[model samples]
Target: SAGSLQELLHVDIKVLMAGSTLRKVKSRSWKKQRHFRLLEDGLTIWYKSRWAGKGHSTFSVTELEMVREGHQSEVLLSIAEEFPAALCFTLVFHGRQGNLDLVAESPEEAQAWIQGVRKLIHRAQTMDEKERLDQWVWDWFQKADKNKDGKMNFKEVRKLLKMMNIEMNEEHAFHLFTMADKSGTGSLEIEQFVHFYKILTQRDEVWKVFQDYSGDGEKLMLEELDNFLRIEQQTGERSAQHAQELIERYEPSETGAMTLDGFQMYLCSQDGSIFKPEHQGLYQDMSQPLSHYFISSSHNTYLLEDQLRGHSSLEAYIKALKRGCRCVEVDSWDGNDGEPVVYHGHTLTSKILFRDIMSTLKEYAFKASDFPVILSLENHCGVEQQTVMAQHLRQILGDTLLTTLVDGQVPLQLPSPQVKIYAVGTDSFSLLLVYIPTFILYLCACRLNAHLLIASGHLIPTNSSKEKEKCGAENCPMASFALFSPLLQKSKSKLSRELSDLVVYCKSVHFHGFEHSRLHAKCYEMSSFSESKAKKLAKESGRDFVQYNTRQLSRIYPSGFRTDSSNYNPQDMWSVGCQIVALNFQTAGLEMDLNDGLFRQNNCCGYVLKPEFMTDGNAQFSPEKPDERQGYRPLRLSIQVISGQQLPKVNQKEGSIVDPLVRVEIYGVPQDQAKDETSHINNNGFNPVWNETLNFVITTPELALVRFVVEDYDKASRNDFIGQFTLPFKCIQAGYRHIHLLSRDGTAIPPSSLFVNISISELS
Candidate 1:
């Protein structure tokens, strides 16, 4: 009755840390007492109602982002007047999941749960593959131990195998069960079950590969290990020093040489990761001008879901900022309360107090990236509320907000995000109007101080310029940014002039032809492009687009037709050197994967410097005709699909077994796009092997992304996506590697991976 947490009485945690009945608070009017307990493994939490239930309700510590105490969340704050903040705590989860608000009977109890959960989360995060596997097995053991006797009989083992999507002959199952039940009690304990699991999940694939490399059929000498790395992994490096270090690190038992155990561990290490470990740190140059890098950005940063009927909350801003997004959109409108509100205007999307959003921005702006954030203001508020917006921004952001130009002088190019803590461009001031009559209203927003202000506006959903709305057409947001023009500045009012004078580096402008831009467009004048328009330009005038982005900042956003808040492939825009390719941060898909993959490096600072060819305004570069460009060298990439380890099962039916398949896709220039896949292995979600080789020719490696996809194959219907991992093509290391797969939402499904051999050579 006390639960299996009797075993959780570890030295670090107190005995009372087992479980407690805490009040789960959904709202101020609704609170229910639920019994909460941490499982014995310390990775999962289980909660139940007062009455006994047939099934269990649980949440993993891995799902949690962090735990905050004392009315830290809005839900907890709602009951602050009724309940003391000291007795309340909130569990913040990753992604779009809602927060868990709870109240303890006393402050001491609350601290116990909070500190206990924090410790568990820390342990879960630090666990290695083997440790994770052990916990996973323990979890299964808990599920199968129906009598709560800490042991499993033949019937339960058979049932457990079915639950794990494994169908085995009864005789063979019993034979293995008997082998594990060393005491001959006709039942197996936790240790016995672990041994049985090891027998069932024997790595035959690993043994074959090991036998291929190990000359003595046991261990490898230093030269033999070097040969394995050079010949089998295609590293082509014969070094005793590197081999010795690896042998020392992976080979246990003080063995001087590498053994099968060491080989297996090394194959699953950071050195064996598909993404080069050397690229994990702050490896890229960050000193370039802001425009010279591809910046991680989010469109409609207030909306949590689709544009229509979505709740606009500060959590969206927090999520984006925490994920290293440098550019965040704020659609400011005049609220009925005489304050500015941020939301999708004219739609059923909920509204949030603009000041609250500002406060969240100030708190989380530098948590993920120390780079300067671009606050893109889509102003719809009147002058009075605009002034309030300005006040709140200044008040909340304080010294972090960029008010004046760096060194108080005009900048030739936008400043680097790393060079300053925040603030850079001057064009953060003017062009805040919705209608021409409200031009002075935007001037009222002059009091606002931000690091970088990339301003745009829309009277309705889209700008009413007939030529601009091409079903999925692009609009040059010049009407809203009209005040920044030199001609408009001459006769504008003083308030207007105050804002206009502040329009420094990033003055928004309409993109005409390339010839026109070459002759007239200043380096500071940037352009915004819709997805379709940007794609068209990148296809028709790709060279010009690349050349244009070299000197000016270009932003590409999704088309208005994407009401579901779906994202376009950011790789396309990045290929054309678009600095700001904004996506719906609330949505998850292949597009966001590419965004995450590209920004996963360079300290994850939300900025990746463009390649040298794309950095010069005069450089001859074309994403379409990459083969013809200077220094163009096409490379051949070959990936050998080997085996999958501990992949997750999709179907929940007892008899269901997944037929797994691996697909490799390349996203890049028109000529370099390719896809290759392996045939499915029937009835095997665990340790399926297919030694198929997939090949591709990448003409523009710098702009390409390689994606590895695993799916549960079904001939009768659409296959279920198991997991995938995506990264820039150039980040791949040519060697034997393990690609750790990720779930649909991009979180790590630990211990799930694909073993492979990679080779890169000049295309012949």
Candidate 2:
């Protein structure tokens, strides 16, 4: 039966079950025996019920998590509390906030189901560096082979690099093409293409980095290797052992020294490299309340340029998702083609079809990360278009879209293994219960809860019973709804019964002041503030903001006045533990660069667990109030600016030389600080050694970032930026380090680096 179903669905699926009775968690009705197929993209279950005829439901692999057979009590309790009726051998599948449990014939069948699902998941999770590189190269090759000739010419190769936002000189492009074309046929075959891609993505700087420590430019003895690993690699006491092991593993002879190839192998290994392993853990604690972590987000994610006149395209979504942005905004309006469109409202920006945007999202949603994507939908469409928009989203997103509460009941407390009830706030009604039909909830306000709601308009209060009756009976329809209670500051205000039923977990609250937020409900209270307002609030009450954000979700968006779609420095908000720091995805500036760098950690999964201090409700951490902590140690940083190699010339004109200078800047909460060495005048940009040591004392090293800036000095004008590299101070390794430079757009410039010696000490 599963084989037949696989052929029908046109997917390569391994059969997990030939027949089984499945019960809908929401309805508690058992359907007739059906076949289950595990597809590459998702799981498909085909069944027939008395009320509903033959049908098949497909759940995306990204949305499904397996719960082992014996470890199903907590899941069962979470589901039973929501849906009263259930049977044994039920395999529970968890989404963002919803759970679906399918009943199997026996525990053996359930274990088989779990094992099958996990096998596919394991394959997806174990994508190593080489596998990822291969996938990346293949995706680009497919895009570049517009003619579908299985080969790319020099022109196509150049276009591919440009489309990827990589800048390359024409001469360099020609040279690369010539080298990749092994047969001198002026085209790169698939193998040749992969060879070229490896060259572009490979880290050849390992040779140069090794030479910095070896001093002889050829090999490194055991002591030299140990010192390099201890100081530059930050390997601590095990540096000597690791060095000996590396030499034993990679050295060709008993010379007790490592060559260039040996060093490269060590750098590319799992235990020795900066790159995270492919199966790196996705999260620290999945059971923690969603409000406790910072989620990477993008503002005006559909536009490619200024908010006033930028081009709106599906490419924006792809780019943002690939960069580990979990939350993306979509501004929707009714289009002339009877379909909803997405664009910046009240601006000269162009529009793209909503269906096209959905398609792009489906393809690229989990490419970079497998976290839940929050679609911040700003709806400005008529009722008809609104229904159409909902239809498109449901059809395209399929089961990946979260549409219901996790346990079927409004959570009375924070999520814990025991389902323990935690006090929300001092408010009388900590948890409100109401009943409304799903369709009615959709019709009343498309703004789903934080997970998946359609926002028709700004939520307002209904004062009188007559007003409430009118709001519900006419504007909104209500039946039976189980939703999270809304926490409103105003004591006397009333809301429509239908509207109140839709506010499940994320309650929209207008930010009044810091004092109001401290006393508010923890996980249930949600607030959105403009970037400027948030920044001002953080500046005035940084500690309060940090404490408030510890247990609540705060969304900081771009200021309304930014017509050019410029972004604010997200680090300022991150310093206070603001969860959602939304930025303009199109703007490439220091703010975006910093955003990219911050999210680059934690496996680039877009959701990073807040620091222990930030998540502890009572612990206080403020950049301005460092002395408040009694045992805090100041971080002293020492950087020796050695030299630059193969630095790009600012002016491309012949006979022009760059007067290179190195500027080391430290950015943190107390204030921005910078120290620059004198520019080496008249020394061409090639390999100028300054030998100048710059030192800085940092109070908040955790929130600080060190920036290495290379500039071309000019006598009469502002110096031009040749390259820059910025990273969080905690991620910085000690000792002799080579800092690879990045272009203004943040793409790595191959083989370009600054050699430096860095040491960090804790001040007494």
Candidate 3:
């Protein structure tokens, strides 16, 4: 049967199924033979039954998670109680929550199956951008070929670009199509299509960078190379020796001079990889607790415009998820339809169907990063709609929804089919728990009760008592000493037995003050503070906030003043080790750019582990108190601003010779330090040379970002931003480096980079 199946399938499919065995397992009432096949993009499992005929299912490799031993084994054992002797090795599908247990005939056979599946998974996990791009091109070709033809025409190419959200001029598209159509038939084959894409995406700046140093317009002489290296060097007089070493390393022919191809290879080798191989350990530490990491989060993730009148679309979720946002917010309100809707309540924002949002979540959940997505549900629906909401979530999310503890703890029983939903009622005192699960659901008060709280302020003696009594009473306003005694008596009636079962790890409480967070009862507490309040707290009591956040999760969101849905600098919160620094995902600015840069490390998995000193849970460490630790060393950063290549023009005129200047900024705690050239070079956008050096004394190099901004100088008007580059100091290499400029929207401006030399040293 396997041999016959092999003949029916493609060569690549047969190779993946070559060593694996097919076994018969009972599905419902009928028995079926299961055959596993790996595709370029995903895995296919075919099932053939005697009476029920044949069926198959395909799963994206990104969605597949191999569940072995421990909790997985326990779940299998529970399932086996029904079937008695079913061969079981559980495979959990993320987001979809589909679980499949393959039955092996023997222990050795099961081991082989596990090994084979894991090997495929490992290959999928390590699939780099280039491989994914190739697969995408193939997939796009199939989709664009509407008639199932082997070739695509110019119309199909335009449709393909539209599908990919790429905006290209009609002339450029036709030109590219003509170039790819080698047969001159006005159509492109798959090979030609891929070639066209590769050429289109290829950076032409490599040749330009090479030609910048090439004196003869062809090859770089030894003396010219040496002088270039000397200018690139930070504090060295041995540029001649370094130049000799570089020539020996990159020189391909017998000639002493370096060719354009050889120089391009040297540049490619340096800037090719975003994450260096040596930085692998930074992302590999998954053993730590979830609270020990800073999670990339988005606030009001459904909104795409102004906070009060924005359109709420599923596109927002897709964009945020693709950008490595692990935590997303959903504001659910009961819709006119039977199902619930997600939107900002009390606003003119349009709503989207809850089911549609769930479907979007399932599709794009693991596309950017293969990590668990946290759905921060802000429920505003009534009990009936809440029940319907839970039903839809169960039907949609299925098993991918995390119900139990993922921290390797063995639960008393397997997670129930239903989710544990929690909601704060309109009355504010009433807490509703709709499902049966031991997991905790955080519920924050929607409305502010400043007037009521201020009137009853004296009744609440201290912030600690306020927290304790508020938890017991479930009141929006902190129960006062007068109200606390009676509330404690009536707490039994208000609190349900299900509350104990639901409240486990995370409990949402309004942040009172820094001192309130230091209390013992606030250990497992989670707090959401406005950005202004958080900044004030950080300034007034930064050390306390840092110590508090070291153990528990603290969320910082934009203040109410940001009606435009603009984002604040998340790096400020991150500097203090705040876990959830929520930003407006729709708006693109310096804030979101820094957010992208920080999470770009660690596979952009949305969760970056906090530094060791921050995670130690000791109050002794502080960014302000740098002298307390030996690891805190003063860094001397020296940057040489050399020249800009094909620098972007502010004005749209054809032959506008714009005046440009470079402004260098170092952002970190203690305050932001900046410096800029006093004068701007006029009449040169092609290549403006500064040949100036700047120095900065960094007290905390670990939490610093070096940002280089290019602006067009104007005497009559304000200077306009041409483009800028921002990156962490840790990733910056010491030598001749290229600073690639990015637009305000975080898109790369090709062939635009500031050539700079960097040298970092410790101050004795």
Candidate 4:
């Protein structure tokens, strides 16, 4: 009867198993007793309606299981299969161990030996046939050979082995390579690699053997290799374990990994000498591409806060605030009778109660450290409204907020200094008209000891019509310089100067700005000639040149820069090409960190333009035609590594030897700035300085060679490390064809840093 009731565990057992009626149990005793009758069996039981609402019911069982274990039979728990309904099931047993004993023996074999759990319930699904070992290896080799090179490089091979959780060093690399290159020509060709692939994929047993041999933990060492050869000489061929042991013996002392050079020595008693010119000075040159950051001003504070909502959780937002983001904007407007309320609009509907937002922030606020959150309140109304809002912010954030006007006027006589307020101005508005003059307001805020003040304004263009008309082309520079001359002559006050610095600090400054093609889509125009002969003529005649014009300057210069076209004029072509070369060096060779600079040049050729800072309705410029007002084009330099050499293996137990500094120097500058010149700096062409005093010892032949990257020159230490740097190659109308190192032209140091040694076997 109990087994039948257990079978109906999911449904009401009284109805499903017992076939008894609930109406028959209707008595005063049934209400107080908390009991029910099973339908079919007419069995009485205690019950509670735990899951009252959702379409589910709860049940519990109190049972006993007694088994003679030595006699050997499986006793299954039927109640445990019902999940949460059997959550409170109590199974009383005569000889079974308790819950604590089961936990303790789980770590030992007692539970495994006594549980009688013969079958495994969970198993993994079968993988697709395409994912077999043979297919994976073929795909890996193809992708690894980027230029269809027959062999895979260290970087490419290392990445694949790393994914398998088997760090394949140089020693193990050749072992696997030789295994795959079955016919042993020191290389594996694509067409001839069919059998290895077939063996790898055809059987799981074969694949497993390869995996074991490839794994570093099981690979052969040098001692094992020698033993294998000695034994094989007496018998026949070498075993896989012997080969693995031979490979393991060549592991480097420092990292216990093998490099290509070390692997070759161990495998074939040969050192390979293949070098690409581009990879020569890789460790010495440190030029890197510039990093970009975007800054935008929200028209009002509520919109700014609303936009940032989904980016991070409230907890994360508070965490970020604690980390460092001090300058924050809050919009406020005048309430009834000019009581300040934290709202961005003049209308009352847009107003948000200050207390509500503060309460929400407090709920999730990180309060480990105390750092003031600078609140910039913009008034929709006039200065009067701004004054009222400042008072309200001071009340809400206390001394954390400050109030000041541009003319060095402070409001509210608080005991401690309040927060600094900045007055923002636009190109269309003068400083005095925008709430408070920005510069003067910043000074006033500084006098009150405010932490930050942001003076928002537009950078007036150098080529503005008003500016051009005042001085024309010849005197444009003088006119532009004259306008700012007066500001430089003032008797600088401590507060005013400090405030000016604040403005400069907060301003989004662009360094080495250039136009890029991605953002400035219509900046350059490309036209192709129908006939190749005509196209050649046009290109030769300097008539088919494409031009890039900035109808509007980018928010950041060179946000969208372009390259030269195939049909461009020689002068234009060379200039664009030089720029590409220069930018390449800037990104790849030098090691200076720039806030903003020329990142990289595209494959397409065209000159870059400073996006017009401000656009004019009347200003017209042709995209196909050039004007001298576009300014002087400067030549850029890109560095290339020509050649390099590695030192001979040495025994490190002896004295150390210093490595020679490999240097490349570029020298040449045009004597006259105005000369239409084509001379490299100092008439020697573009030179890069590369000196390598940094050295590591090779103490033992066992594992001494290590690879290190030479990034860029450290101005302070006079050494090099991999870092961001920029070498500004200054040449106008100057063409540098190539980079050279140690040359009457470009020579190598032949054998300067090479060192090798051999010691007696007794030293080992």
Cα lDDT computed for each candidate against the true fold: 0.77, 0.64, 0.63, 0.25
What does each candidate score in C-alpha RMSD?
8.0, 15.6, 14.7, 27.7
Best by the lDDT measure? 1
Question: What's the true lDDT of residue 511 in model 1?
Answer: 70
Which candidate would rank higher by TM-score, 2 or 3?
Answer: 2
Which ten-residue region of model 2 has the weakest summed lDDT? Answer: 435-444
Report the alpha-carbon TM-score of model 1 versus the true structure.
0.88
**Number of backbone collisions per candidate:** 2, 14, 4, 68
Query: Candidate 1 at 387: error in angstroms?
Result: 0.7
Ranking by TM-score: 1, 2, 3, 4
Candidate 3, residues 498-594: lDDT per residue as tens digits?
A: 2222323344555666666566423445677779878877777777777777667777878767889988988778778788899997887778777
For candidate 1, the 10 contiguous residues with the lowest summed lDDT are 435-444
Best candidate according to TM-score: 1
Give candidate 1 regions above 4 Å deviation: 1-12, 15-17, 51-55, 234-239, 421-504
> Which whole-number lDDT from 0 to 100 does residue 526 have in model 2?
64
Query: How close is every model to the real structure, measured as TM-score?
Result: 0.88, 0.62, 0.60, 0.21
Ranking 1 against 3 by lDDT, winner: 1
lDDT by residue (tens digit), candidate 2, 32-69 = 44445553223344345545566666554433444434
